[model samples]
Target: MTSPPRRLPGEGTAHTVEQSAGELARLAMARMDETLGWYRELSAAQRSQVGLVAQAGISQFVEWLRQRERHAPSAISIFANAPQELTRAVSLRHTLDLVRTVVDVVEARATSLAGPGDEQLVLESVLRFSREIAFAAAEVYAGAAEARGAWDARLEALVVDAVLRGEADDSMQSRAAALGWDDVAGVTFVVGRAPLAASSPDAPAATVDSLRRAARHLGVEALAIVQRDRLIAIVGGTRDPLPVVEHVADRFGPGPVVVGPTVPHLFAAGRSARAALSGLTAAVAWPGAPRVVESDELLPERALAGDLPARRRLLDRAHRPLTESAQSSQSPLLETATAYFEHGGSLEASARALFVHPNTVRYRLARITDVTGYDLTRPRDAWAVRVAVTLGRLGGTGATPGPAVGLSDAGQPAPVGRRGLEESSNL
Candidate 1:
């Protein structure tokens, strides 16, 4: 009885908007194609998503008018019907432009689409709805950005793991390409103990993010991750990478932060990774080493700790080149170096032992540096020369007791002790 008594007049503006929804959506799309350059460039599927969004906007405005008295509609729900690819294919700015286009179409047709007394009301409602929808679009984009960031982080970790494991095959390379690391050249690898994060569970990721932000200022590309207690980073520097590494060294944990040599490209970065890993393990031997020392500087410790690559590097750079310099004497510089180190790096003692004058010993020391790049006066350089020369002798003697492998300080034959004998046999 009450329902039949006095039925209020239909909401004219809401009815008109509902009737014109299909046409208004078409007009909005047409206007977008006419005005927005980026919109025209979109693929067919993306364009279809844009159409769905425009149609939804008109329908939502009608619903808002009808249901607003009891429950205000969430303008955000206007985008609920849109596909996920809509957000990815269309940027926030582009989406806002589309929304503005829909609003413009509706406003331009307000006079014709509304009942006589409802035109101004429809126009005002459109203004308010657009403002709310703009905010809703921004919130949607914020969520997309958050999701994209997490996915990119996981992808970066995969690329780094692949590179470190020397699995730089096509599959890994494709993944790197997805991360925009395909064309990068001259990548440097850095290794150190991951910082303790007792105060925060997310310290490692935060530290890595901070490091990457710092590196970006230098125009460097950085990919870093923390694996348990080990922090590994692969840095791509266009200029001298050492300066960038030096600038970022304070970010690492309290331990040796070893930087490896640069390789030609990311595909070849495993070589650098190996060296950095070996240097990090061997760094404990040199308590006085710099916190950000190059892996090459730790060659002596690495070679001594059974890193075959380091041993081969020392032999090739110093022993082989020095021996090659003397075709007749088989590395006379070798004997000069042997005497210098055996006498506690004393030039006079080395001269007395080699039966040469002090000046001749001094001249030979300069030649040693020229041939081997290791200065005998520097303790680290002396350590490297000792290891290289010892490896050279042991490598050459092969199951035979030789004086070269165990030379006394007096430049005479010394006994190959039980330890030396056992060590030499393995070589």
Candidate 2:
């Protein structure tokens, strides 16, 4: 300088304070750059799935260490969800690997710091690194938990939308595919709506989670979604569906629960969901019956088997009693006919269901054609009879006619025509 520098009041005391603050700031900046550099190096070497998350974990770890030293409880809460997030983005496997890497680095640094002169610096750096690791883990855990919550929400929305519209979204199909659900031949959704008691130890929502765990334990891959108002789940890719259905029913309590039929693919999950919806609807419409409403089970054989003419004929037979004869109550006749044909012409059971004697059932059978003009006991009339019964039930018609003769030795009577009449055992 051309001249001596002028000093202000308290210049001597303030100089020392300014110098110390500046030094600490520089050190903090340097440490941050170093931490970031380490993450970049690791990312480059491993080609990790989420480099950004990894870097964020590193930065967050440093911040966590600082906050913890300052005793910041609020800051810890802010990062409580971070661990799950990190796990979701980078995967649990990678997180563990990164943790291992941090451990190894710390160990190597400790070994190098054995000399007397470097002890304090080594100790400080080790503590900082350890704190960072802990925070990163916390964040990753938080992230994973968050992802699960989001998945639950999305799944519910997709299911409800598909059910209401009678179709599935492409995004849901893709998400299922991403989760390795390739063998998704069909889909079925189950919901538990009854409000669990507040005091109950095992609530409905808790039961849903338990069932999900049970499915996983049994190696049945599935998704359990908990919504604000309901519990929903989708089960698929198995050779058998009944066992799973029964399992869910058992969980929700043998009370009012609904199950849909097996549909084509992941896209058909909604169809099943809607079926569950229908099952609930039907259960409400007709109380104290089976809560299950399979599309094929409730609809006529032809409708399920896709035989339109047979359905028309069965419907014609079922309704003929109601319209053709003012004296005849077509409702009971249709119910009996449906049960008889559905049971493949088992009179005893059909009679029992209709609360009529077996012979009364037999007389009713002989009268199907009299009312509908379609022979109930004929081989050619079987499909038509079945279809009519299904349409009748759905359209408020009655059952198909009973078999003319008794069932064969195998229990199934021969088809409508050319029957060497199997022995007609008294019902």
Candidate 3:
């Protein structure tokens, strides 16, 4: 068994300090106000609370001195009598200032306050008690800090859940507001695999911290959540999200990271979230997809996977523009594109099929690219155009049929180039 702590030789001075405790408490308060600016800044209510805490410290010191077998009072328990709000108003540093003032006052008066020849004992005891008070102050503040961190984490999780669920109601807005998301603009959603922790169960928090640190380094605001194996982030205050997402890409686990289109604010972020989630879900279809795939870039795969929004997007972004161009400009942009793809992207083969020169076919392909944003020469753009053409044919009404130049099985290609020249001359 451990031996009992040896008693300091100041038990005789215990009664001396008890008699002067009231005087010492008054002096400590006066010195704290005079020497510490923060102490004087405390509100009237907070000042009263500080006075009570100082008096308690001195009384507790005397009580410890009077006990034959001394036990230091629990430092954590010192703030128990004061209101919890007092800890918020008076910071730990300022509490140390009060403790220093109390120690200084007692030490300065030790010679007169102690019994004859016991001044040294009184001064030593004051030093020892001040050390305990400092330790106690640290414990109190640490506990408060821990509680605050936990509360903030829970609030963050709630806000993330609300965003994911597309619940942008007033209650959801209020929660986001509580988390200081009000100032953030141009919100975007990013979806990727969550990083695996090296060891600890707190890996989720560690992963989140890594994301936050990366975002801060890049001067962006981010809120993250780990849902099972997936990590989702709502990034804000950036119109250009690709660079921001690229900078923090390594924070995710090894997988495709997809960024959604940016919205104006957090409430509209649900649109971004939906698009990101759709891309993430269909990312596997394109195994060689980019590290940071824009949500719209995955439209073909998402549409093939039966995503209605993706299907609608393909039609709006590709088919509608080409059809409008063909009607207004009298160019067979769509027919030439269909023939070019069907003939395995051979310009000469498409030209013969359309009864136009190879140069004419090349010029029409360029116009197709201009209208649909897909260059028929590239493989990925060709595939996207193929999907958009299929969607268009299936959805279009009164699609005119002209030449059997390998359009769709349902309808012939509208001959608007050299093929249109021959037919119009015969007419």
Candidate 4:
């Protein structure tokens, strides 16, 4: 059998603390108003809720000292009587500040609230109770944080999906706003294969969170979600997203990571998302591409992969320019460039086939570079130039072009024996 609990000498002190609980709560509020800038800024309704919490704390302390509670006082009940909104209005730090202020008020009045020989007990109890309250506050906030994190994760996925699917309506905008994504400027989309380690359904969120943190460290705003095998990240708050993508490129799985062109804001992010995803699909064609290749950089591959927009861009920027160059000038750059590719990139060979001086071939090559920005001498540029020329000749539907002057059935310029005069045009 348990021994009867011995009576403590603090009964008189407990009775005094209980009787003065209302006045003590008022004193704590006055002290908070003087010391806590945040407290004074609370709206009237919030302040009223806070007052109830303080009153509960003081009455609970009296019971704790009376041995009515054999265990640590439950702060859960203190918050129970208060409005749920109070938890958010008052952060854990502010709650702790309130606790400290109340503790200070109680300690200052230990002399009056305690019986003659019970002053020491009252002071020690305040110190112990304050420690308990601190622990309780941490526990409460930790629980709140977990619940918030889960909710935010679901909301994040919805916002990301909506953007990817081009459904960013007012409802989606409001949902994105809930996740703090409103007003993000210079938004861009990045797509890459999810890391192998995050292949598990439960593991992807943790990986995305790491990416989000890395982006935020650079002052970029980011939202992330993993769809199927792909990890999509929408980052903003920076005009140049190149560095931001490079910074987090290593966090993706081993494959080409594609960053789309930046848009003005979140609402325009679907354009970026489509391009980046298309680029990621086409990236496998170029094994030597950089770890973080921009969507614009993969236009040729994407065109070859049947992406209409990329095909249109190649037609406008690459293929059409070469054909147009022939109209304004007598030299046939398209025929010369094709022969240059057929003869193993030999500039002199292409010159012999065209019967122009090597210097003329060199000049036309320079003009080609100017017309389309593709340097035929470089391997990558050579490949892109050839692809564009082929697409233009075979696919150029409405253009002012055909096999000019010198010809073979194969559409290449037929070689002429060295002519007395060299090819020259000033246009």
Structural similarity to truth (TM-score) of each candidate: 0.81, 0.50, 0.77, 0.86
Per-residue accuracy of model 2 over 1-427 as CA lDDT, tens digit each: 2544222213332333233333433333344335544435433323333333334443443343333242212323333434333444455445555545544443444434234444454345445555555665566467557667556535544444444344446765565555555456766666555344412434533655676777766656666544333455677666466677666655554345555566666675654664454344334433434544343332233233323333443355456563444355444566666778767777888888778888988987777666666666775455555555445556554443332222222222222221211110000
For residues 83-109, what per-residue lDDT tens digits would candidate 3 score against the true structure?
Answer: 877877888888888888898898899
Q: Candidate 1 lDDT, tens digit per residue, 234-295?
A: 99855467888888887888888999899888898878887887788778989999989999
Highest-TM-score candidate: 4
Which lDDT value does model 1 have at 316? 89
Ranking by lDDT: 4, 3, 1, 2
Residue ranges of candidate 1 with Cα displaced over 4 Å? 1-10, 69-77, 80-82, 116-120, 237-239, 328-331, 355-359, 398-427
Question: Candidate 2: which stretches are off by over 4 Å?
Answer: 1-86, 114-132, 169-183, 198-208, 223-232, 284-427
Q: Using lDDT as the measure, which candidate wins?
A: 4
Give the lDDT of residue 93 in candidate 1: 92
Write down the RMSD of candidate 4 (Cα, Å).
Answer: 12.9
Error of 2 at 355 (Å): 24
lDDT, model 3: 0.78
Q: Considering only N, C-alpha and C atoms within 3 Å, which residue pairs clash in candidate 3?
A: none
